[model samples]
Target chain A: MSDPAGVIAIGWPQLLLATGFMVVTGGITLALQLGVTKALWLGTLRTYLQLLALGLVLGWVFRLRQPLLVLAIIGVMTAVAAQTVVRRAPDAPRGSYVRAWAAMGLPALVITFAVTGLIVRVEPWYLPRYVIPIAGMVIGNSMNGVALALERTFADMDARENEILALTALGASPWEAARESVRTALRAGMIPSINTLSTVGIVFIPGMMAGQVLAGADPLVAAPYQIVVMLMVATADVLGSTLVVLLTFRRRFTPDGVFLEKGWRPHAR
Target chain B: MDVSGPSGSGKTTLLRTLARLMPGATGSLAVDGQRADTLAPQRWRALVALLPQKPAILPGDLRTNLVLPWRLKVERDVAEPGSEALLSALDEVGLGGLPLDRDATRLSVGQQARVALLRVVLTGPRVLLLDEPDAALDPESSSALAQALVRIAATGTAIVRVRHRESDGLAARRLVLTQGGRLTEAGP
Candidate 1:
């Protein structure tokens, strides 16, 4: 039996071994594509730097151990990230960032908090290890899913406005015109996540579970946490993406319910 | 009357501006005494549609091309009722016996123009704006199209037809467009 209370110092060797699979594949992909290789190198370096810097910032902040402060930081981080996602997506309607965050934030907060609170019996739920990492990961993925879902769905709305209008003339409501886009885009966004979900244990052990195990915790505890994370991911994606689409649609049409051309502007920017 | 006075006329521009796929347009547009921007152009647009000189036929099954316009809300959904009769209205145009299921995108250029015309007619719009509508037609198709336009006009539909050669034996008001976007009548 190990001392479950102790903190693990993750050495560089273990880190290399843990990340080797991803890094090797990324390098290979970059090597195969000429220009993409440069982008890959820069992106990898930037990501490494950001993670290191963020880890330091989070380490200092976590020492304070105030739950309210932690919650406030999470809110700020999510808000900033959500705004960036919207801004990067071209032809994203006005007020998309604010609206999508408001929609995604609700379900992510409620479900993650509920599951982690009741299921994981971490003494300080605000701990950097227990809640912060999990929240950061879950919320980050949720933001991406919501952005992709919203972007694709909005583009579809613009491109197919004529068909949608034709349906409207045939006495179908706005939602009916929107239903195909929403369904198709949301389903498309979920593909990667679903692949990850389905292949969790067999294809590769997810980082959280493997990390917990390597740190020498009981596999049982690590398993439950991994299960919880996957469930939270599904909930976040379904609820967050769907809400954004719904809210975006409300803005998609005119006062009398005409689908706006601006709704479909490709995120060329 | 459905005619353009001469070359360099604002006829195409006038039709395109109303269709609002035009560039460099700024002004108020009134339709049925209402604001232009307020209307669902894709839906009610066909009501005053301007068929392009070379109409674009989207790649898809013939049925998809034909029924695509009826899916708009302003033309079908918001109306009191009877919008459902739109599909059968295809027969009312010259496409009468052609398989209702032909690939529109693959239709020969001449056939595509006719299918496009059929699409406009099915919408049952109030006006027709044709831009060199017969430039791609065979003599037979040209004759057929001319007859179709006359019949559609008989329905009291407002027709704004543009062409290089002036139409004969039709009640028409000729307004030529000169260089620099000017509209003029055939010499006073």
Candidate 2:
């Protein structure tokens, strides 16, 4: 299915229906003197451009199911996801973007391979239909997890500086001193996934399952795929956040367990 | 030895530097003639402990907080004291018969201070660095704390304490920190 019939293609008329709502919202904001009209219009334009570019790229990439091409696509997505995480989490330590990249990229790659190769068992093991969507879900969730973990861990360390230093002063190693903060960060990072697990079926159909159903796939099949996606996403998120926090906490302290006093940064404060 | 100075005199900074808690501090500190920086932090801390003005108590029972540091991987190689030893240390700090399961965080500041003091004493460090050890204590508690320090000192644990009050340093060799971080012996 080189050209799988496009999924519920929305023509310009249908898009105009959505655009009309945004325009009305912007108009109301302007009339009320809220001054958000510019933001509304700009956001709409940016979203439209980004999604259009993504659709075009995906269309080209999906036609060629070559392993190298598939890997390259996933790599680019992971890089963008990592950069997004670093940008969103501005309070993280300096030079944390590289660590963020590894944290999100490694876990996403591993989870994508396990799902695509072991469970889903795609014929080429790099099917754009399966691998691309799964990679997007896993990497996207992992990036969010990494960002949350970094932000929370840094804040926790700052708030609990006394506790950390107390432990260190009593012979705790750097890792030992940061054990509590790491635990807190991991819990904070993973809560979204845990909440999703409980709310997946009853609350609302998730995006992947909804898209599959809209594309004319069987609900039963889409439901199972959704379950698989959820598990992979949670695993990637947990692993990514865990690694990022564990790696980053060490940088906050000296080898001798003394916390390196972080100078005041505008966002870090 | 006692360190006395006005506010912002760096007395607390000196104590922390000697304890190796402040990485930015530059100077050579020694314990038993051994260079402090040469020793591993775990080893150095085991030998020289600092009791900060406000001791941070973990979220656990008194017993757990007392033994928490020893439970770390770095301290795993050292032999931990038995419950009896811990109780003895508690008794030495006027906390005899205090329930082992009592929450450390819930203790009064005075009681928590003693517990923090007892925690370091239990480690049997060769030197104790104290920052206003009785700053929060009442008269009775302060006297008790003094006796505890005397007993620990009698055991050959050298103590260097920072004190804001003149009366607090009467028994020790007092060094006043002047305006420019200069150390001078207190006048008689």
Candidate 3:
């Protein structure tokens, strides 16, 4: 059955049919004694439940269409993303949650608004449908970037402690001593986005593009949106990673430019 | 001057502290009557350079390693040595035959130690902190390093050399670190 939007409706039967595919995969895993059988079933269950909950939440937000509610949801999403970043990078020093929040939130919000307001030209600019999805993608990608950067910077600093000390002893400032580590972290953070940009549409169809096509948008129209999504994701990733790295590297040194070895080491507790 | 002590006596820690590379170190330090606290850390480090025991070679050839200090903002106003000056500096350190294009990472431990020393020396520190500069060197290379240190000390730059051996014929005054970390004056 088709809805008024002319998109074919997917009912529980179709969803259950999809679950059958996962069941077949789970069966193979069990047959092979792959340890991931439990993970596969648990992940499949969570995906179904989480997406359904997201659909209900989005429906409620869209119906009310209040800007404040939209913003509150965005705030919650950003906070969760920030916490996820810190959690993923367990080696990051203490008090990184606030820094991660700022790093991920600021650029992601700015870019989301810029895209929705300027590029998509969504009316009222706070339309839940446009802002939430766009902000979700931006914050999600930015979170990944920030997490990778924090992890890489801490690991690199620990590994190259001697090199950093050598630099400082040569009259290099703290920034100068940590420069190589920062560069490596930024590269690590941005490389996935760079690869996505280069290989988009050829290696695989991105999720947003696939969704838009499945909803019956013109391929040409959907292509530009996907392009915008890819570009914005790349921009947000680089900016977030840069901010996190800059914020965190200084913590590796004292104000006097001495490399504090204990500062970057993962705490025993 | 030479700083000597048995192993585990905090000799390396002393040199690191003097160069202001130790964060836990506390006490007043002065250079040429100027207090260390009054100086920017970069400036303080430029005045007092430390050569760590392990040689750290940057990812480049010999020329890049030698010229690294000059590239730092703290050394911006200082003149970078020319190829001739760098060549001669290598010569002075008994690495006369090493090529400027030679990859620094490929150098022997002893050779890299000398290059590490040369890297710090090029910064023209007023106080040089060497942590066992001769630890990896052969007798011939060690002697060359001693001569170089003597010449550098003659230029009025206070040199602090940490040595495991009793004699290098370079120190006019010596200090010894006891097991308890007390420093005592010893006759040269």
Candidate 4:
């Protein structure tokens, strides 16, 4: 049982390839969004430096083998990222978006460690690779889902504030006034993942299954894991999005259900 | 009912409070015999849309803005109003046959207000709370705005004017924001 993974050889090549992929992804996103070459270079490089620093920190921590520590790191990352993204959305209330992210991230992380731990106990409960990746997969998707959910819900409230007023006119309570936007926003947030499910293994080869196969695992062995991973991601995203929308709806509006423009930012799309 | 009084009487605050932004507000003012403080104001607003001091226009066509409220789940029956309807509403408000696809913000102040007022008409808010409206208008534009308010009021939508200056030509009940941050009724 010889391991090809070596501090002994082939180090810079792997590192270079990973760096290349990272640059390409960030470059494409920035180019499409902002369309400035210098901006893309600087933005992507910033992202590269940030991820590298984080990876260096996580690498040492993971080697320490405390599952609880791994869970905490992921939890904090999700919470902070969620706060950052939602806080920047246009028209968001001052502190509500950041608070909502923490609220969503806390529950999602608890579920991450608890439910993932319960299911992952196939004799050795602390498979760092699986636990970490699966947690990342679930929580990362949840982070995006929550962000979109908050952004859209707030936007919907702003754009359709009259309907909210109408609902209020029809004797709907403040919570009831936001019901439509919340539903539409939640549904909107789930669409990408739902579409991904429909196109799974067909439109593209998913990375998880491909990675397992490359590591010499059977396709059958990888298939169930991939399927479970996809499902969990969808579940976590939906749960996190739904909770964020609901709690956020309560905090986002005036008691009369007027959309508080200060609570969340706007999505350009 | 015409109310004309001094400046800084907090007329805007009255509208905002009426909208339920002050959930923990302990004081009370009744609107048509119901406590405005406790009544669910969103519902109140559907029947009555307040045109804020400066209702911002998003970067979109006039038709889109007019009909946006109808698409909300709460407004299942009100279809997105067509461009012709929006244009017609605008026309009724003295902005005859303006471009519906024009960028709203790029419109002149008077033009934008007409479009917004048309939006209220098409969207069907029964009460119009206008804040310092027509401050930027030329005399002709202000006169037209005055006429539009009269016509809208005739349709039974109560119009409340919070004005900083008199003779914007709105012949309606006016609430003056006093220097002491209170509303005292006055007549022209």
lDDT of 4 by residue, B26-104 (tens): 5765556766645445445555556665655545877665665564434322456676666676777777767777677
The predicted structure with the larger DockQ, 2 or 3, is 3
Which has the better TM-score: candidate 1, or candidate 4? 1
Candidate 1 on A1-269: residue-level lDDT in tens?
A: 33556546767787678667667867788777645656766776787799899888788877878888778776876787678668655666777888777876777677757766787766677665566776776777777777788888877777776555534433345686678788877886677677778989998998888988888779898998898898888778778788878887756665434466652433433
Expressed as tens digits, the lDDT of each residue in B30-127 for candidate 1 is 66777777766455464566666766565676566666665444444223223244344444444555564566667778777877776665556677
- Give me the candidate number with maximum lDDT: 3
Candidate scoring better on TM-score of 1 and 2: 2
Please rank every candidate by lDDT, starting with the best: 3, 2, 1, 4
Candidate 4 lands at a TM-score of: 0.59
Please provide, for model 2 over A1-269, each residue's C-alpha lDDT reduced to its tens digit, 9 standing for 90 to 100. 22375466778888989899998898899999998889889999999999999899888888876789888878888788878877776657767777877887788888998999999998888888888888999997667777888889888888888887777778788888888888998899999889988999899889989988888788998899999999998899899999888767787876567876556233452
For model 1, the superposed segments whose C-alpha errors exceed 4 Å read A1-8, A11-49, A91-96, A117-129, A150-184, A243-269, B1-13, B19-72, B75-92, B101-112, B131-139, B162-171, B178-180, B186-188
What is candidate 1's CA lDDT for residue B110? 78
CA lDDT, every model vs. true structure: 0.68, 0.82, 0.88, 0.65
Clash count, candidate 2: 0
Higher-DockQ candidate among 1 and 4?
Answer: 4
Tens digits of lDDT, candidate 4, A170-213:
33566766777888898988998899889999998788898887
For model 3 chain B, where is the 10-residue window of minimal lDDT?
Answer: B70-79
Candidate 1 chain A lowest-lDDT run of ten: A164-173
Off by over 4 Å in 3: A262-269, B75-78
lDDT of 3 at A120: 97
